[model samples]
Target: MTDVSKIFAPGGVLSQTIDGFQPRPAQQQMASAIAAMNDDAGVLVVEAETGTGKTFAYLAPALLAKTDDGERKKVIVSTGTKNLQEQLFHRDLPRIRDALAPDAIVALLKGRSNYLCIQRMDQFISQPIKHDPAVALQLQQQSRVVKYWANQTRSGDLGELTELAEDAIILPQITSTADNCLGRDCPAYADCYLVKARQEALEADVVVVNHHLFFADAVLKDTGFGELIPHADLVIFDEAHQVPDIASQYFSESISTRQLQDLAQDMRLLYGTELKDLRQLSTVADQLDKCGRDLRLQFARDPERGNWREQMRRAQVIEDSERLADTLDRAQAIAKAALGRNKVLDQCYERLVLLKARWQQLTNTQRSGYSFWYETTPRQLSVHQTPLSVAEKFTSYMLAQQMQWVFTSATLAVNGSFKHFTDRLGLGSAQTLVLPSPFDFAKQAMLFLPRYLPAASDPTMAASFAAIAKQLIAHNHGGTFLLFTSYRMLNQVAAILQEQESSDRLILVQGRTSKRELLDQFVDAGDAILLGTSSFWEGVDVRGDALRLVMIDKLPFAAPDDPLLQARIEDCRLRGQNPFQDVQIPQAVISLKQGAGRLIRDALDTGVLVVCDNRLVQKEYGQTFLASLPAMSRTRDIAQVTEFLSKD
Candidate 1:
């Protein structure tokens, strides 16, 4: 019972229960550590590399832990992505439960938006949308699908509707957001799917969620309204490297053109049905729409995105935003006077209130440790203010909750140091552990650095990169992932390769198809080269020879001109810290590690990692990136790389 082998041994429950389950030393080590942890262990950061069976490492201990009453202790498992969350909830948890904790109850809790709101769907069905015929048609078709799922689905999660695209236009119409939910006042409150799901999560011994939902709930709890945090004694964060970024996003204030337009459109619907002669409100709503357009036109002149803090203080931007806020305030006054008692009108007014509040928060930037920025798309404009440091806030929030925290990821540490991750989360004194993947990288993998390729910043780099990719694909006969840092470079290199490569070899590029679809195609084709950007860098697992070669265009460094990156650099500079070393370098190292990890996923899996960036070998900081990766066989000779690929 003291060792994990009692459960993971050859004749143990796990081996007996799961098919082809060969236990690894890393998994046993991690499980032992987690089982030994108690509430007094402030937080634990574990860097379990690929193939470490990290999910079971945490889940096994969580399921095995019990209360005095013999009931399993509640554990909340939060992942960085919905895919991982679904896998944990639908696939992995069942196996673990059947083997160790059959009595353990499990529930999957997504955000409110993931559940269909019967009330909202009904309202949308009843409303006359005179705008786009295509949209109306899509809504009509998707509504029937939603209705069918509504009848059959116990969870009522939108994820169950696999036929619909993730970004389907009908989703928002049938789904409820925090701002739009009628709560207990809704007619369908009794059978509300979102509420029912939350109740299930509350009752379950284990709950699976994503980082966004976890932080949203944490923020809500800070405001005294969150429901799930109080019930769980242990919280496990998978893919925990994404926490700092996701936390910063949720903690910030943001107002977008779409929010304004949605509020206006909702007001129009309510005005037409519930109130009349509110011409002033209609005019103000029209003004709000115009203001949004004006702001986009004004900002879109420069780059598609930028930090508008200085420009936000300028006369034009400030005046326009104030005018938009004022219009909403006037609409609120008008709604109260005319459509005071109407429920639909009340909901519209509530949305307006939130819109106004968000606008105020975005414009008012007198507080310290906050950076303001704006992004402009062809159809939308947004203003955001994020804190320079979410570490203090995150640490306080976790400490106040008093739960045993576990943060595990394959990419948390850089150069064998957890300081970058810990400092970012203000968990400086927390316990940290690194469990390297049991896979023998040196024996199974090769790190190929081409000596003849152009520098990363050179104009001919794309052509050189494509040539290298073609050679690798030719040698390996597919199972290659050509990952780029940007879409522009991805498209450029992809086009170059497409023109030069044989027509028989399947080439799948991102953005041309859905990620799931692309992965399926890649696996089915077996000999296909996938050219993708940031999304394919991590959380993409293709065990066996289906994915063997991973080529990164350059170190995954954020664009210097990026608003958030720029702000972080400035923040570091202000603190008298070297931004390149303290911020950019560490971040890139983590990202590079994630990209490289895409190659060797399992013990038997073997591949070559080719970083096209000469800087990875030539720069002074290159050693840091090299040290951060698994100790694979390094080579500069093309002959060695081709020979290694020729083998298993």
Candidate 2:
């Protein structure tokens, strides 16, 4: 018998480690499949439902894979978020190793920015105030706190500074970036914290990373950190549904007005003593800043949400963008003439050169298989050139690396088809497995489709959603997540709930506070209604009766105006396909699956999933969305839903 079956048997290690652990057939099956995978099998795509113990199911077999000489095989376990990476590294992996593989070594690696650069921090502290003394004074105060921690910390991770909050202005100045890092030439190269972390990852038996970092290393080649994929024997992706979007973002070319301004500011600071030519350089910086401001205003004239590709072709827009690029080129020449062999100045000059290159790329008409667009943020404007499709390149990358892959997530399939996901990654021929959750969903949960509501796009839909949500909260006595697709809807529904004459129930809305604070309030209130949007849709877990209902305001579809989505839609149309059915509907189906999964976390947990959009029941594709959900009891009867919630 295999080690997998022996360890997963009735009286095995897991049962002993976890209290009252029942042997799950689904878990055992998944472990066996993972144990059986070889290089010849290529990739394995597994859709393990919510309660299937997926983390352990894969981790157990991965831990057991070893050479006959008893050397541990190197493995990379990549998750979709840093929270899960922390959980796996600090919590789950240790417990599993203690119970199973006692000698195993595991390391958690995050992006370079997550760690403090001792060199950068020291330089920041020693430098005289050149710009903004108020900001300088704040950094000086914070550096004292950081200095003490830097001496005591082995990891140099910023996460250890509990007193410092995430939004602290002091962080960006102290952290290292690829553009700013001097690499081997830095004075503190021997003691660099980020270099030490990478060394540890290189030697560890198992490495934990988030998807963003993994994709960066896999494709972007120059993510500052060296290659990780070529060194791994196997790569496992948890929450694999998020890979396509992250890949799209990492592979694209982006340059922003903020980036240009930062380069200019850094150039100003890199020079130590004031040169006689300082006034000339300062004037050039100011002119470039004005040009950036003008470019921002030009983009803001059209507030339409999506790609501004056509707008970029406008004669005035083209002239202005070229002028902005020219101003920067002139500024670069002035700086090169003023500054000597200073390393800091060299790095800043390189950034200026790169920015110019991106501008040339953005405005050039020769590039095919790419979408050129511009977007505006509250503080700045940006330009992007994204590939119309990354499928071919991604597939070639995976094959070139020659590492066997395992991709698992609860939300990978739509209407029992894996084509939506597989095609996106160009893995149509990979081995596939669908393991349903062992939870008795028919008894443990119910799908409630509220009938006869306003269209999801209607302005008054928020009021109707609030009315239904209010009734459900009254019936269930709280622990509800009122999820909206848009911030406008979220705010409107929140206001309506506030104005309604109902019994006092704690209501926590997103953006009112930090996400951590909101979740803490929700869990502590125990009977509170949490109003949120996209970020709250997934990666949230509230087990048992504390989260008894998940009320989604509409079908979770990507906005038609999103630049990336629009590009994908046009690509599909040009190929003579139904973009709505093949692309849009499948994508939304997967999102709905993720949102509905917040409930029924454990075998005994129960709840009701309420989708307020009547289109889910009226549209022809409604059944496609409905079929992708767990096989739970379904109904439109309000009384039935009320009774289910009212149960003890």
Candidate 3:
């Protein structure tokens, strides 16, 4: 340990110790690695297991590296979710600041829209919202949540409103768009949260931000990283697995049909009249809104939206989409041309053009690497595609930056090789290490793939899942995560499982009780079955046997009929890359690995990882999936599963 680490030792007055929060070996290793970066290498990729205090591990090195002035020179920490962003900003940053330098200025910087837009908010407050449902309910509320929050908030970030439901609040009414911002000249500029946060970031020794903001700053060169970075000597990235995805998005851009609709809303705000301009912008907005609704109606609507049955109409879609695409393209140009004369109008128009272009390119491409999809809500519509690789892009810009770059995640490596991600991030010859989770996998978890089951898409598969549920239900008796890829599948299986069991049980589904509350209920109950999907795959932690049986319905493969998947696979084939091995199989393997990870969260945690898909035994690629997981003994026999669960 260095002098700085010793200063934070348990007995030292300056010790940054959390009571009962014992640090891990990986934390120490990571700290050593970060320290090594000052003299040795610039990049380090670490796979910190769930129980590893990875945050502090990286933070230790980060704190040690802070210039003599403070901890906030050019440190940019990024993560996958907004929740984590708040966690670091509110919790970790303070602890680090107190332990290191009290004067260390650390600021949390999010996107522009997070801050309250006084211009937009004024429009929303004064006028009667036309089509927005959320605004309707808020108009009745005497509390005026947006106004109250706007009054108190330093950031104007709508995210701070934990009490507000996303459906109950209109984001645009409070959030500012980049183009619509009145800059420093506006009346609200003196107390602007965005400006304050920016000023803090510019002055701080440590700046905390998300991966999205970091990439946007680098690519757009818009949010002013230039002011903070050049004077700073080092940069640190946390939750670095998400960097590539965010990096690519920043490199490219998206404009959606929803922009036109927003433009109309903006016109309502700006014109403060009957929208009498030759622009017909409001009418155009109404047309775009209707066009989206009509075009979406062309698809058989799935209430859950993820359903292939409701969404997929193979031959019929191409014809309908072609005409829709051309019409959108023409409208997009009109919106853009109109924007040149009007600032707010221009933002709305540019937004539409970008969406139109994105939608057309993604679905139209037959190339390898990219995936496209049609995504929409009643008020908004967008088509987006994930880039095949951002490796070249990331490396060309940031690779040569002579500073510490740390990428740590629970899921980054596949089959013990970091190459899948390493190649993608273009971290050529960077120091790479996969720190095996200290959790005792053999004792903590058991792998189970029930004997019966058809393919995921088979009509009869739901019935088979119900029968298997009976046996698995008997084992945990109720404290189990019945994870599904489809909401309909979960609803169907939940209906079936209810018929067979007599045991007292609590059932919770995603989005019903709020994820945190549902988790609270799930954790408190003596017997519970929490049914969830994608969001639950990685984060949920029920340590020390509260969670025993992790029953995956089937191997999670990307939906074949998905517009995005279809485009990416075709694109890959054109490039001569094996879509299965290069993309699909590897991607599925990562997701499965994340789901399986829920089983063993702690050293004492023990459970059965029952992957109900028999394909693990039946197919050649099954081995690939199995090989992708952490080292744990496997068995084809149900006797082992029962024996493992039978333990008190």
Q: In terms of lDDT, which candidate is strongest? A: 1
Task: Give per-residue CA lDDT, model 3, range 394-504, as digits (tens).
Answer: 887764565567788887777777776776678877788777677777666667766766877788887887777667668764378888988888888877777766777
Single out the weakest 10-residue window by summed lDDT for candidate 2. 221-230
Clashing pairs in 1: none
Ranking by lDDT: 1, 2, 3
TM-score versus the correct structure, for each prediction:
0.95, 0.94, 0.84
**After best superposition, candidate 2 residue 415: deviation in angstroms?**
0.8
Positional deviation of 14 in candidate 2, in angstroms? Answer: 1.4
The lDDT per prediction is 0.83, 0.82, 0.67
Q: Across residues 21-75, which tens digit of lDDT does each residue of candidate 2 receive?
A: 6788888888888888865336999999997888888888778777546677678
Report the candidate with higher TM-score, 1 versus 3: 1
Q: Give me the candidate number with maximum TM-score.
A: 1
